[model samples]
Target chain A: MQGRTRNIYLIPYMLWIVLFVVAPIALIMYYSMFNIDGAWSLENYRRFFTPVYLSMTLRSFWYAILITGFALLIAYPTAYLLTKTEHKQLWLMLIILPSWINLLLKVYAFIGILGFYGPINSFLRIIGIGSRQILFTGFSFIFVAVYIFIPYMILPVFNALEELNPSLVDAARDLGASPWATFRRVIFPLTVSGVKAGCRAVFIPALSLFMITRLIAGNRVITLGTAIEQHFLVTQDWGMGSTIAVFLIIAMGLTMIMTENGKLVK
Target chain B: MKKVMQMFITVVIAALGLMYLTFVLNSQQGYSGGNTLTVYNWGDYIDPELITKFQQETGIKIIYQTFDSNEAMLTKIAQGGTSFDVAIPSDYAISKMKEQGLLIPLDHCKIPNLKYIDPRFLDLPFDENNEYSAPYFWGTLGIIYNPEILEGMEFTSWNDLWDERLRNEILLYDSAREVIGMGLNSLHYSLNDTDIDHLMEAKRKLDALSPNIKAIVGDEVKMLLANEEAAIGVVWSGDASEIIGANDKLDYVIPDEGTNIWFDNIVIPAGAKNVEGAHLFINFMLDPENAAQNTEYVGYSTPNMKALEYLPEEITGDVRFYPGSDITDKFELYENLGKKMTAYYNELFLEFKMHRK
Candidate 1:
């Protein structure tokens, strides 16, 4: 009776998940299998396999990987350092401060910082390099993407690091292991969940980002996100858009499963 | 205990059911009252004060909403979720709406002020008989250039966009039609050509023009060009008007090769809940004084014949605004291509963008 009563608390949330989440995914799968005329065919998915579109998918994966890698590299150290600090809450707040601003505002702020006559160029000109275009480069695209998505990477890892058992490291050191080996064999292995969690958190959104690619990257980055926008918004081809979205959805599910696999390993 | 659990589940379900009921009811409702008019238009496309004036004169309240793109507006209307009495879609979009039977023929008797609309804006291919649409604002695709970059070099033709010296110094329109249309016009072809071969040629021309173009941009082109990030930007005349207002070095020209002329016109959709209120609103907007105020505030030229008398000569004399100077013969209107052909254009546009990457 007690367990049944507790299960009742989940009904509202389950209803929401059904209405907003599961329903939309089902609708997208339905749309992906049919044309605008409601005729069922594999044409939409076939279009995704064409050479040009295949390249876009690859490009999306490439950018997503780089974003995840950089985010993990930067966030691990910051999160590890935060675990040693007294005011973890204050430090986390400072780390996530920029994300509190609206995304578009953050993008514009990046533009102002990296534009042709922006502060970066002005400072460079003072050092005699002359003004150069930085706002629309590939560097700016990845930099802004990492900037926007780093917070997601940090919080999970920070929690994992905070909850880490310290006696295990001391035990490994007491067992005649060097400090380096202690960290390599004990601490790092224990934090795999956090690293996996951080990667899962950062990689999925990075794969499908549309606005940052357009604003900071100029029209150069041809990722899956922009292709979906063109089909859905510009071309009004909902079927193709849904097809790409279905792929992205599957990719996200697989990523989540991979993180689950990491948890099961322990 | 079983009875308590069942009762708890029932209460939770009832609460959720109430929330869902409210959501469904609120998604749509009859206009606030019989006299309320729901107007859907582009963002910043109208003068807000004119809406207040219309309400004061007619005692009809308006619920105004804005959409950023015609595609978004079309999708909303086609879904039949919202019933808007008045909507402003561009020329090709209005034609698409008409073909889909989403629009109702305007009752001419209700819009008696239609006589004040410019004849040049009437009887065009989109609505040849003026049966469905009335022009609200129109402009041409043109280039806004910095005199500092093109000093003593006349930017009188499309070839100027391809100047070798302009490499990485140009911003093209992000729109597929305008970008591909310029390529068509450069080869002396129609802007609305759906021929596969012609489009292939246009694709080739665009590929060649790629080295010069820094980016294909939308509304951001205004701020970018004004800030001198690019030497030239392809944009609508009204955007150029706003851009030139901000930056002294900038000037606009509709190149002699040809250009797409577009109009945003008002229409009543078939599912409109208040047709009478919509017609009244349209006619009120056509009134000369109201049109002139809209023209001044929106910074786009009006089609009201009598509104010109009230506009300052700066607008009247600006060749980009009035379109009386040169290239009148080169005015081309974008026609609504059927779904299959539209897919072709979209495919080619995607290929072009992919090729750039």
Candidate 2:
């Protein structure tokens, strides 16, 4: 296969990305630079310099980090445990079965689980502890976000763990390394790629959580996605909405660059 | 959703419209997609059986779509090239569409059933003389509260929402206008007032009320209230009716400080292909029985005077559905403040959302 003939297969997928992704992004760029009347301006971006709006953009980044960190903490162990399980495929299936449910439905279910009269609160009442407001707090926001995206973290880490060389761990243990030291020295160092990949998978979606933020997080979590929605859908300010969307896209790109840099460091 | 570049969708829709036009004209006579009407409306706003009946009577196929909000509907039609014959948009949106040239002047002469609509809703600020739109459903914002939770503290004023005694027990409407408008109403300022000091006053009230609110929410407020997770909430009349039905302990009240009255109106977009079909559809929807059916199904108050006779006594007699003139006389309909004021209000709202304690 000559270079041109071999590259023919890439054409279809390249066209798909260009049409669906690149062109739409180009349009957003166009919109971010103009108003509804088609006047060329940076007025939309200028509006975000206010402290309140600026904080929302920053808070969204903080939330993405929080969700990614939490997902890693929980999913790393869950995935590692899955690696030790007898029916690995069946266990993985159970892990992914919830994700297959509708995202909105899942968020609604979280509301039921975390509400004042919910099972958690009922259990608390039974234990002689008073019922507390749990559903609309910042804690519940991250919990649901972590709940929704943890599987993304788990799958990649699981694959990476499954690919671990057994000889390396045995060699570390034979050299008088304790269980923790053997795992840290041999297993952890090699799975950096998977952790990085999982962060990539989890971070971007978590950054743009609009619906779940409203349902689970309540008014407490005003993210960049919420700001964009207010402008575009509620206020009918498309230019402003596009500006926030452009900011979001750039923020995600920067994250990707940072993740790639981490890979380069090793 | 990030890829939904609303600004550039106009061009794409124009191109699609051209292709659609070609397809429509190329087919055989009488079978050439000539008798089809396209409608865009709020989800569950109308009685579906009426649509079926309209199609059966007129022999016109109906293609219907539903939008969740006025802005969403406006964005779709604003993209242009849509052949949507009819759309139901809120009042402020009608003003915006009229200013944007997105709507055509409705032919009142063709719509004889417009006579059946109440005089109160006609010749309003959004559409003077009802030129571009007809009233569909109108409702007011009110406090829906559980009496047992509030310990029989009769709630009547906007300040009641800010009551510190109700800390973390209040559920505020997630809407920028309605939430902030309630504050404006508390201070006796117009909800559409553009004065910086007045808006700042409302902001201060909201900032003060911040500690008391459990959440700022939309439709989810109903379920939360029904579950007794929230003691009180700001909700529209229709939602209040349904939720009150579910939980008998909950009751709806329009505060003495006054609140917003909104209208979901039916209009024909400028580029509609079947203007006659649009008029016919509007007329059919306005038929007293059809309008009554819609009110019953959607649980929103109808603006059609003739329709009131057909509605059940329990629904028509519900004070929330049709509050007394003394209370309703003070209700303010939302005005279209255009771009600059809307931006300011939106900014104020974002600041309120960011308010801590």
Candidate 3:
């Protein structure tokens, strides 16, 4: 009777999940198997295996990995610092502030800060490198992606770090485990779940981020997101777009599974 | 506990009252065709006043929305989830939309004021008889340059982008078709060329120009040019006008390689509930005064002949907006390349990314 009541309370949330998540995903799969003109075909998937598509898929994965690595490097410390802070509440608010701004707005703000004629460029020019443009480079794209996903990475790792018992560290020190050695083995291994969660959060979104990439990277940077968007929007090739989307989902899913397995091993 | 219960009841009553007020307002406005009408159009492309006027005229409240690209608009409409009564899509998009059966043919008689449209725009190749779309606005893509920076160099053709001197000094439209098509045109091939060799050559040309590009930009071209961040930008003539209005040093040129002549048209989607209201609004916009005012505010050319007549001589005579016959002849209107070719172009565009890496 208690189980039945709990399930009934979950009905609204389950309905929401069905409507927003399951429906779109199912539609993507369904559309992927068929051409837009209403004929069933495997041609979309076949085309996706072409060199061009494979190369794009590779690039997206590579970029996402790069962003995740950078995010982890930056976020772990920020999370550690926040966890160590006396005013934990205030520190949490500071880390959460950037996430409060819309993702696109954050990206656009980054562009204004980093573009060729942006403040950084203006300062660079003042120092003597005249007329060098930084607007459309690969660096800017990665920079923006890292900035956007850092919060996602930080929050999860922060949660894990915050939950750590002070006694564990005290015990380590009593046993004469140096600070670096203690952190390397104890703190990190224990925070693996948070790190895994943070990686999933950042990597998945980064791999499929077309809009920010398009805006900051000057539409010159192509990712799986742009490919899907192009197929669906510009070409009206829903099949190809959906196929690309499914491919991305599968790729991300496989990576996540691998990450989880890796965590288990550790 | 009693005070808390009173507060809760008072809050619920207020919420109910708000809902009732909204229902009454919607009914009074006569826009009660449905709960919402999701209009997908270019961001910042329309005059908000026009939307306000449309609502005021017919009690039809508009839930205006925007898309950054035609493709974005098409994607949402194709899914057929959200209900949209009307959409203003560019010429090429209208052709593709009609081909996909996503649009319903306009009842010309219902849009009575469509007669005020310029004859030149009416019988255009995209929608020969204006069957599916009514011209909303028209413009050509060209160079909007800052003379202070571009000082000695003449900006006449698309070839200028490839000039080693101008390398990393020019800005191009971020759209794939615009970038590739103009690159193809610079090489003297048809912008719609489907031949792999032709596309490869266009890609090579684009690659050569890419190293010199400051940025491949969209909406910000106006601001970039105005701020003198970009020496020259490939943009619509209307955008050039806005930039020039803001900064007198900005001058526009219809590149000698010709340009893309784009027309945005109003089309009623196939399953519109507010078909009558849509037609009424379309006709109302066709009025010369309204049309001219829209042209003035939006900085795009009007297809309304009466509106053209009302435009000041300076605007109508502006060569960028109304280019010479020779320059106009070089430009081409984009056509619906069908699905396969669009896919091919998208692939080629992706290829550029791979090459960059």
Best by DockQ: 1
- Computed on alpha carbons, the lDDT of every model, listed in order, comes to 0.85, 0.86, 0.81
User: Sorted on TM-score, highest at the top, how do the candidates line up?
Assistant: 1, 2, 3
lDDT tens digits, residues A5-107, model 3? Answer: 7786698799999999999999999999987566999988898889888888888888999999999999999999888889987988887898888877887
Candidate 2 lDDT by residue in tens digits, A1-266:
47866586587799999999999999999988987555899877787676776888889889999999999999999999999999999999999899999998888888999999899999999999989989889999999999999889999889888888888888988899999998787788787778888999999988988887788878789898888888876666788889889988998898888887746213
- Which lDDT tens digits does candidate 1 get at residues B1-357? 578689989999999999888767655553354678889999988899999998888877889999988888998999989889999999999989888999999999999888998888887899878899888998898888998876756688887787888878888766788888888888888998978899999999888887787777678888999998888988898899889888978988888888889899999987898899899999988888889999999888788879888888888777777876245556999987766677778778777776762
Cα misplacement distance, residue B24 of candidate 3 (Å) = 4.2
DockQ of model 2 vs. true complex? 0.39
Error of 3 at A258 (Å): 2.5
RMSD of 3: 4.9
> Each candidate's TM vs. the true structure?
0.90, 0.89, 0.85
In model 2, the clashing pairs are B123-B129
| Chain B TM-score in each of the candidates | 0.90, 0.90, 0.85
Ranking according to lDDT, highest score first? 2, 1, 3
| Clashing residue pairs found in predicted model 3 | B29-B59, B167-B212, B168-B212
**Mind listing the fnat for each candidate?**
0.51, 0.60, 0.51
